[model samples]
Target: MTTYLPPEVQAGLDDARKRALKKSQRLSVQAGEETFRVLEAWDDGFALELAVADHLRGMVDLYDGPTLLSQCLIVASEEDGDQMRFEYKRMTEATGEQPVDFEKPENAPVALIGKG
Candidate 1:
């Protein structure tokens, strides 16, 4: 059966959905001793803007779960009632291994001829 909701009812439903999304979709970032809930997140970093809080500056480290993401610098922060927006760039390269040490010699490859 095709049923239609009233315009008012539909609008209310949409508003509810939006709120639910915000409630569920949030991350956290460590700012000084306190951790602020991330209102929005991205590949580079997360964002938190509010009037009352310890000012975030310099390098802001973002994390996903317990894993730390690339460090980001506070490239931009506007003070509007302490309103600040930080745009960041990934600092560390994605390479799994640590930066190569030119001073260290390469280990000779071992042959496993007999062992499976």
Candidate 2:
């Protein structure tokens, strides 16, 4: 059997799917002082709402809610409808500060057991 949905029903379903995706992601991009909701994210790059001008290039930070995921230098890749794709020029994971003490013999030159 085959079933077909009305045009309006299809549109409503599509809108609901988009909203669910955005809510499930819980991700945002911080560019300068402005933040934008991320439509989707992958290992090498991510997509943002098509709000900025074309050919955007700069450093942006990706965040999972309040926690920062990484700092990335991005170049606009393409635009699909209301979403814009960006490819990462460079990506650096956010690192935490570590205190070093030269006075301690165990930490004389810093530990490197599993830092490879």
Best by lDDT: 2
lDDT of 1 at 29: 64
Report residue 8 deviation for candidate 1 (angstroms): 19
Give the whole-model CA lDDT for all candidates, comma-separated.
0.58, 0.81
Give per-residue CA lDDT, model 1, range 1-116, as digits (tens). Answer: 86899999988986685456447654556656776656566565445655433367666556655666555666654443323456674455333567865756478555557766
Candidate 1 versus the native: TM-score? Answer: 0.51
Top-scoring candidate (TM-score)? 2
In model 2, pairs of residues that clash are: none
Residues forming the 10-long window of minimal summed lDDT in candidate 2: 102-111
Per residue, candidate 2 scores C-alpha lDDT tens digits across 61-115 of 8898999988889999988876788889999888785556754566466645875
TM-score, model 2 to reference: 0.71
TM-score of each: 0.51, 0.71
